[model samples]
Target chain A: MTYCVGIRLNAGLVFLSDSRTNAGMDHISTYRKMIIYEKTDDRFMVLLSAGNLSISQSVRELLQVEKIDGHEEEGKSGEPITIWNATSMFDAARVLGATVRRVFEQDGRALKQAGIDFNASFIFGGQIKGEAMRMFLVYSAGNFIEATGETCYYQVGESKYGKPILDRVITPATPLNQAAKCALVSMDSTLKSNLSVGLPLDLLVYREGEFSSNDIVCIDDKNPYFKMIHETWGQRLHEVFQGIDDPRWDGGDSAHPMMVRSARYDTMRKITHPGERIV
Target chain B: MTYCVGIRLNAGLVFLSDSRTNAGMDHISTYRKMIIYEKTDDRFMVLLSAGNLSISQSVRELLQVEKIDGHEEEGKSGEPITIWNATSMFDAARVLGATVRRVFEQDGRALKQAGIDFNASFIFGGQIKGEAMRMFLVYSAGNFIEATGETCYYQVGESKYGKPILDRVITPATPLNQAAKCALVSMDSTLKSNLSVGLPLDLLVYREGEFSSNDIVCIDDKNPYFKMIHETWGQRLHEVFQGIDDPRWDGGDSAHPMMVRSARYDTMRKITHPGERIV
Candidate 1:
């Protein structure tokens, strides 16, 4: 079990990952799930992974030097291109997909025999020297889908618990720091609801064209901002919830009445007696 | 997919369920998931179910006359007894479990042969005369576990998206109306994030000693309070989130600084070059 998120916005990219992993409740452990690839002025990419630890680790290790058939533009007719030398983020993602496929080919049979699925997925995103910042969700089968305006973020593992706020607040135009804030808040909700997702967190914010960044931090329980987020979000949320008027069952002249007159009410179904029919 | 929730509070019980069901995206349909059994002042119970619709529907049909051997005291050594004759909520729950087992015995093999799971679960709770109110989560195997003060609530199907709110707000002492308000809010979050859970909700709130309640309503997309909740909650949540200070990347002299010094930072993992090793 794990939780990781990647957001591509107009301002930059925000990546967050939790470190908790568990084979069972008794086997809880810490393992970082974020990786950064930096070539200074050339390219900047980040990978956030979730699923079988072994498969993801193999994919990450192979992704750096994994080669693919390059188009003739790179050099010779069939030069091998790696993530380090690829000219575009799409090419890098292809190399990553190939890496995943290789690992699956090697481990898929044995894992299936042992009753384990070849489960591995990743959020791979960043900027190449010339192209705009891009992001993708790479599936276990080595296929991938890019993030777009309607869905500018990708999350894997324990994602549903943290999705509502992201749905309500995120857009392509959200500012860099604010999206980072949103990512942390989303992670906070996840950490609160799931025992298998936890801190210290690995958070990295990459500016749109920076090819690299210093905005990386490892957040343990004591970090001031995360602690404030954990405390204030819940308390303010409680205050906000209290601010909303309670449902008025009386059907009086209230501003917000829980019971409204509607024809659809008659269409509702309920079985009230032993001999009652469903109809 | 479906969403059903039941809460046991000191004030009474609150049950909420959505009516959406889907075998696949192409086969989405509406099906009520809550059942009410009441004999006025004598006893009252509600069933909120989720899982394979067929199994649940069968279990519900069988539960009424589905009897088990009554204890010797009930009559001549082994007279029939059912939920209608059960005195304690615990005994009533046992009757419900037995009804589930009967359905399993009838359909389990056929479902397994077709590769469909014998899946079904229920949030069954209510007050029976001569006993305190109780709630149980009935699983597929017909085994059940009672809700306690610490847990206070149970949710089935598409549950995680709606759970954080419940985790933050619910308790045994929470007032009945507020708990109802909280339940609707939880459902609202689930609706926003999941297309499989749709409009027209079934909500019922029973008071501690009332035995039965008139405070039942079927809320559709047009309901005003729900519309208010759907709008105000997201807006207010955004406001609350905005009030929380954004993470300070610069480590400025602010009230909340995101980055603080910690020894664990040195142990953080990152890959800066193609040849970099994990250790």
Candidate 2:
């Protein structure tokens, strides 16, 4: 299992992925699941993948050389229609979809024969010279969906544990570093709750119109910022939890009381005697 | 989808379930997924269920009269070994498991033929005379696993969204109301993240020694306490998030910084020209 998230905002795109992969409890391994496709002034893109290793590797390998119909016509043979020359992020994603389908065509049947799902999901997002930054969640079927104003981010695999913070913090106008902080906090929550998602984490922060820069880092247990986040967030969260007054059964002095009278219904019905049913 | 959680603590047990069910997005209904069976001085049990509605309903129905093989020998003819008369919580859970299998025997084949799983999961917990309080997660196969000191809670369906907070807060020594508050907070997180899990909610709080009490409540949209929790938790969480200073990139006066210089690798790689890939 893996947890990968990509956010595309007006400011730019942010990408993060955990490196833990496990065949079982005893077979855990660390594998990088993020790839960068950059052509600075021309285009900059990132790919974050989750699911079976073989499938993702195939997709990555094929993506470098794979082509969509138009891309193949544009690029010379052997040069390959790579992420480099794509006119738009949409076309780049299509190249990605084609790469995924190529892997599926090659291994989907054999995997199905072994009762394994051809499950692979990708968060592909970036900026091209002519268009705004965009983000997409590519599915196993080679189909894809883009994020919009209402939903400005895409997360694939082990997404739930990290979602609440994202839901609370992200916006199209959020600054790049704030979004990065939110992503790390989200990753921290996921790490606390789930074993399959671990560190060192791959984090990339992109600023709009810059194509790309040196904002990526691998966060291990020893990284000071991550270490501070891991400790501060947990301690502060517990403080907040404790700060919230516990429920007061007697409607005590606290401004926020737990036991409040209601007009809607009585307490739950219970069967207190043998053969009794309170309906 | 539904969300139900059961926690066994040193002080007592806590059970919480949502009341939303949907056949499709177009057809939604509210159905309570909790039931209580008690015989005052003898026993006190609560059942929280999730999964296929028909199967769960059938299991619930069967539980009224379902008896296990060994327990039947102790009953008289035509007098069902009901939950009320079950001598121990384990036996009561076995009866619940048998009830589930009986439902499977009746509809499992037809459901399988229709490509729908005969899925139903339950969290059954309570205290029976002469035994300590216990909690069990009963599965479709009629096999069950108990919650011991190490793991004090069980959740079924739409559980992941709300799991992090519970993981952080729950312990054997947590007070009953606080645990109940944690369960509600958990449910709130699930409700916010998942459309399939909605209100009203069914909450049951149990005490260790008391056989029964009037602490259970059906919390609908209009319930004041729930309304407060929904509003306060979201607001307070946002406050906490804001209070935590945003990431500082240059290690200014802020106590926590975002970027930590490392010797291992350069920041994320970028390509400056078309056809360039970061290797």
Candidate 3:
């Protein structure tokens, strides 16, 4: 299991991934799940993967050389269209999908015969020189969906445990560093609640139009900023929880009371005797 | 989908459940997921359920008359045992499990034939005449596990989004009222993140020694206390988020800096050209 998040904000893009993988609880190991593809002044892309480790590793190995057909114009028929040569992020993602399919073609039947699914998914996002930063959630079936302004982020593997904070905080308008902070906090929640997602995080912040990024770091337990986030977020959450007034059962002079019953439904169904019917 | 939570503390027990059910995104409807059974002055119990609504509803209906065998003393051979007659909460839970098995025997084959799972789960907890407060998480196979002091709560359906708050706030030592507040807060997070879980909540708070509880309420959108929670929690959560310092990318004079990188791993794998191999 793993937890990885990719966010595309108005300011730029944020990519974060945990470095834990497990075959079972007893077989836990650390495996990095993020990869960067950069051509300095030309393009910058990042890929975060989760699911069967073997299949993902295969896809990553194949992705660099994977090519999509028909990109060649008249005289350019021999030129292979790869992630580095694609004109758009969409094209790069298609090549990634093709790479996934190639892995499936090679391993899917064997895995199925052994009673395992060819499970793998990826968050592929970045700029390809001419377009704005784009992000995608690619599925195992060689299909994908793009993230839009209305939902400016994509997450894969063990996503739900850390989702609420992202829902409350992220939007297209979020700033680069703020969104990065939010992603770390979200990862903190996942780390606290799930043993499958551990520390030593890989975080990369890409500023739009840079076509490359220098803000990349691998955070471990000793990292002060992540430590601060882990401690402060929990403490402040407790404070906020305590700050909210508790429900008043008596409906006293309080402006808000818990005694208010719903107008649409009857009181909760109570069965007092063995002969009673619920409806 | 549904979201329901039950918690047992030293002070008492708390149960909260949302009322929404949906077959698909377009077919959403409201159906209460909680039921109470009280034999005033003798016992009080609550049941919160999640999964296939039809199966749960059938189990609830059958549970009224559902009975276990052999509660009879030597001479009372003909006497049957039911939840109403069970002296301890454990015995009552056995009856509940038997009830679930009965439903499974009746409907499992038909549902399987239609390619639908016989999925349903329950959080059952309460105080019986001779027992301390107890709680159990009952699974679809009619097997159950009790909640201990270390892990004093159980949730069923759409559970992960609401779990972090419970992980942060709940324990055996928490007071009944405070646990109830925590349950509502947990439900609030679930509602905010999931559309399949909606308004009109059923909340029940029972004190340790009491056989029945008057602190039962059906809260809807108009409920002020819940409204306060909805507004205040989100606002305070944002404030708490902002209150934490954003990561200092420059490794400046700040006590915490985001630039600290892991010592164990190399910098992220970067593909510089189309011919690059990840391995």
Candidate 4:
């Protein structure tokens, strides 16, 4: 299993991915799942993938040469559309979708015969020279959906354990570095709860309009910043929990009392005999 | 979809369940998913169910009168074992499992023909006289596994979003009130991230050595203590996040910096042309 998250904010974009892959409990290995595509001053893109490693690796290898016909008139010198020359992020994502479909056509039949589902998903986001930053969640079927201002992020694989933090903290106006910190915090929660997602994280911070970014790092257990985050966040969360008053069940004259019964639903039913029914 | 959690600490047991049920996005309704059984001074048990509501409701209705043959014989009248007369919690759980199997025998074929899986799970926990507290996770096939000291809790249905908090905060030594607070916090996380699990929650707390518990409450949106929890937890979490320093990208003289690159892997590969390959 893998856990990867990408955020597109007004200030920039943030990307993070864990490096563990497992076929079963005993067959665990480290596999990096992030790739960067940058043509300086032209476009910059990042792909974070999760699901079957074989399928994603195949899609990544095929993506460079994958092509969709240009919409130009016949007999004209229109180059075949590719990620490198695609004018908009939307078109680049379509190229990615086509690449995924190509791989599915190659491997989907054999995998289905083996009773394996065609499971793969990707978080693709980047900036082209003339366009604003865009993010997409591309599915195994070669279909995709873009992020909007109202929903500014996408996460794939082992997502639920780390979701509440992202739902609470991220917004369109968050700064790039701050969003990066939040992503790490979210990842910390996931790492603590789930063994399938392990360390040696890949993190990238892309500033808006830069077209290319150098803010990339690999974080293992030795990374001092992430170590501080792991320790401090857990300690501080426990402190916060301790500070809150426990529920008052005695109906005391407290600001919040838990003893009050709901008016809408009756108190829970307790059966005392063999023939008792709840209603 | 539903979310229900049951935790057994050395001090006692805690159970919490959400009350929303949905056939589809358009067909949403409220149905409570918890039931209690208590023969005061004899035994006390709580059942939390998740899956097909019809199946669970059927199992609950059938469980009261469901009987297992007793081993006693030799012309003596041995009353068929029922939950009310079961000598141990394990025997009670078997009866519950047999009830589930009976329901499946009646409806499993029709449900499978309609393309719906006969999915159901339950978290059943309590104490009967002469036995220590026991908790079992009962499945659709009438097989069950008991929770131990190492894994002192069980969750049924839509459980992942709420798991991190419980993992962080719960242990065998945790006090009853604190564990109750932890369960509520877990439920809050699930409710915030998932629309299918909603309020009017049923929460029950049972103390060790007590055959019955009156600490049952139905909590709705208007419950003041839960309202305080919802507000204070979000606010404190935000405050904790703000208190942490953002990552330093410029290699400043800070203890933690985000600019260091990985020594193990090269920077991600870039494809500049249509025929470019990663290798």
Candidate 5:
């Protein structure tokens, strides 16, 4: 189990991932799930992965050399269609998808024989020189879907516990650092709720139009900013929860009364023995 | 899909369940998943179900007359032991479990043949005369686990999205009203994140030593207290999220700096084409 999230905001793109993997409760290990591929002044792409670690590792190793046939014959001159030479981000993602399919062709059959699912997914997103910043969620079948303006972020693995915050805060117009903050808050919730998602996070903030980024940080338990976030968010949430008024059931003169005569009460299937009226 | 939670607190107990059921995206309907049984001054129990609606409905219908063999000969004098006549909540829960097993014996084989799992669960908790408040999570196979002080609540169906808040808040010492509010907040999070869980909740609050309760509310979309919670919690949560400072990455003289040199940074597995230094 892992938790990884990638966001495409108007200002930039944000990528974060956890590093814990477990085969059983006893056999737990840490493996980096994020890989940063940068060709200076030309392209910057980050691949965040979840699912079977072996399959993802194979995909990543093959991705550097895997090539897809060029969509147009114009760019077909003696050069292999790889991420470094791709003209657009979409083509790079195609190369990534092909790499995943290659891994499936290599291992999918033997994996099925062992009754293990061929489950792996990737959050591949970044920018090339000529194209706008884009993001995609690559599936286990090597197919992919890009994030749109209406849905600007994609999260893979253990997504539900952290989703309410992302749904509430993220937008296309959210600033880069704020989106990063929201991602961290979401990660914090995931960490608190799930044992499989641990700390020592890899956070990358890529500003739009910059082919290379310097906003990469490796956050262990000692990172000051993440420490503040982990402490402040939980404390503040508890404070906010305490500030809310409790429901009063006495039919007292309160601003928000708990017991009101609802029309649906009579139709409810509440059971009681004879000579007892509970509603 | 459904969301139901039962909490055991020192002051009393709180039970809440949503009324949405879905077989597929096109086959969505409303069905109440909670049932209250009261025998004045003797017992007060609420059964909250989630999973295959048919199986649970069958279980609920059968629970009324389902009887188990008495455990002790002193109380086994030609009497059929049922929830209505059980002396302890434990025996009542056993009767409920037997009822579930009976349902499985009736329909489990056909359901399995049709490739549908015999999935069902219930959060059954209440106090019987001379017994303390007890809560049990009855599984499809009729095995059950009781909620102790260490884990004071049980939630079935779509439980993860709403679990972080409850993990942070609930305790055996929490008051009844506050616990009820926490349950509603948890349900709100579930409703916000999942389309399968909808409104029209049934909430019951019972005090210690009271075998019958009138503090039951049928809360639809228009209920004032729920409406206030839906409004205030979202708004205040947004405010709290905004109040937290965004990470500053430029090595600025801030209290929390984003990019700090870490020991693990040197060992990170960042991939890049040659001649580019990203860290």
Candidate 6:
């Protein structure tokens, strides 16, 4: 299991992934899940993957050299085009989908015979020359979907544990650093709630048109920003919880009362003595 | 889909459930999932269920008169006793189990024929004298497990969306009202993160040793405590998020730094040009 997130904001894209993987409670190990593919002054792409370790590894390997027939293959000429040469982000996604299919062609049958599903999910996003930053969620079946404003981000694997904060905070207009913060906050929630995802995180922040920068870090337990986030978020959340008044059942006597007068329903039925039952 | 939670504490037990039910995203309706069976001064039990609605309803209906053999059926005098006369919580649980089995016998076959698994989960908790209070999680096959100090709560259906807060706040020593508050907060998180769960919540809080009380209410959109929670939690969380400074990449002049030299690994490999790739 893993947790990886990719956010495409107006300013740029934020990519983050945990470095832990587990076969079970006893067999846990560190594995980085973020990959960067950049052509300075040309294109910048980041891939965050989650799912079967074997399949993800294969997909990553194939993506480096795989070519989509329509977009990357030679047009009656002897030219090799790949993620390195795709003209648009959509073309890049097509190359990614082809890579996934290549992996499936190689290992999908064997995994199926062994009673395992060839499951994999990816968040691929970046910027290409002359186009706005684009992001996509690619699935195991060699299919993909682009992220739009209505759904401006994509998450994979142990996603639900970290989803609430992202839902509350992220927007297309979020600034680069703020989106990065939101991603880390989301990752912190996942690390707290799930055992399969652990620290030594991989983080990358891309500015919309920069094509590349050195904003990449591998965060372990000792990383200062992550440490601050883990400590402060929990303590502050508790403080906020405490600051909110507890429910008061005394009805009219309290300022923030728990009981409200409503006609839709009454108190739960109460039974007294052996023969009593609420119907 | 549904979300229901029940917690047993030394102070008492708290049960909260949402009423939304859905066959699919397009076919959604409201169906209450909590049932109360109490005999003041003799016994009290509450059932919070999640799973196939029809099976739960059948189990609820059958529990009224369901009985188990070879178990010490409480209160009810006879070879086979029902929930109406169960004297002990254990006996009550057996009757509940019997009720579950009855439902399984009636619908398990037909549902399985349609490829629908006979899935149902229930949290049954309450008190009967001559013994301390107890809570049990009843399963689909009529088997059950009790809640101990280490795990003093149970949740069913769309649960993960609401679990982090509960994991952070709940323990056996938590006060009854505070536990109730925690349950509501958990519910609020679920509501915000999921559309399948909605308002008009049913909440019940029972005090230990007291057979029952009227501390139950249906919370609608306009409920004051809920409104305060909805507003304060979101606002306070935002404030807390804002209080934490965004990651300082250079760490040269920051009060708390993000990047630091580490012994385990260097920075991740970055692809600087189109022809390069990390291996």
Predicted model with the maximum lDDT: 5
Worst lDDT 10-window in candidate 4 chain A? A261-270
Error of 3 at A167 (Å): 0.8
Report the lDDT tens digits of candidate 6 across residue range A98-171. 89989999998999999999999999999989999999999999799999998999999898878888888898
lDDT of 3 by residue, A1-279 (tens): 999999999889999999999999999999899998888678899999999999999999999888888455776764667897898899899999999999999999999999999999999999988788999999999899999999899999999888999999999999889999999999999998899998789999999999877788898898889999999999999998988888888878888876753332366788886454442
lDDT by residue for model 2 (A1-279), tens: 999989888888889999999889999998888888767477778899999999998887777778666634445543335566677788788889888998999999999999999999999998999899888899988889999988998888899998988988889888877788888889999999899999889888888888875677777887778888788788877777776666665556756555553521364544455456553
lDDT values for all models: 0.89, 0.82, 0.89, 0.89, 0.90, 0.84
The DockQ-based order of candidates, best leading, equals 5, 3, 1, 4, 6, 2
lDDT for predicted candidate 6 compared with the true structure: 0.84
Q: In model 2 chain B, which range of ten residues has the least summed lDDT?
A: B263-272
lDDT of 2 by residue, B1-279 (tens): 999999999999999999888889988898889988777667888988899999998887768777664534445443445676777788788889888988988998999999999888999999988889999999999999999888999999999989999988999999999899899989988998899999988887888878885577777787656777888788887777776666665656666556664532454433334445444
iRMSD in angstroms, per model: 2.4, 3.0, 2.6, 2.6, 2.0, 2.9
Clashing pairs in 3: none
lDDT of 6 by residue, B40-135 (tens): 676778999899999998888778767676444476546776776666777888888888888888888999999999989999998886667889
Q: Which ten residues in a row have the lowest lDDT in candidate 5 chain B?
A: B259-268
lDDT digits (tens) for residues B92-151 of candidate 4: 999999999999999999999999999999999999999999999999998999989999
Better of 1 and 5 by DockQ: 5
At residue A35, give the lDDT of candidate 2: 81
Candidate 4 CAPRI assessment class:
medium
- Winner by lDDT between candidate 4 and candidate 2: 4
Candidate achieving higher lDDT, 2 or 3 = 3
Q: Which stretches in model 3 have alpha-carbon errors above 4 Å?
A: A72-78, A261-265, A274-279, B71-78, B261-265, B274-279
| Greater-lDDT candidate between 3 and 6 | 3
lDDT of 4: 0.89
Writing each residue's lDDT as its tens digit, candidate 3 over B163-217 gives 9999999989988888888998888889988888998999889899998877888
Which stretches of candidate 5 lie above 4 Å from their native place? A72-79, A261-264, A274-279, B72-78, B261-265, B274-279
Candidate 5 C-alpha lDDT tens digits along B1-279: 999999999889999999999999999999999898889889999999999999999999999889998766755555778989998888899999999999999999999999999999999999998999999999999989999999999999999889989988999999898999999999999999899999889998999999977778888888888999999999998999899989988748988887764443475676778666646
lDDT of 2 at A279: 39
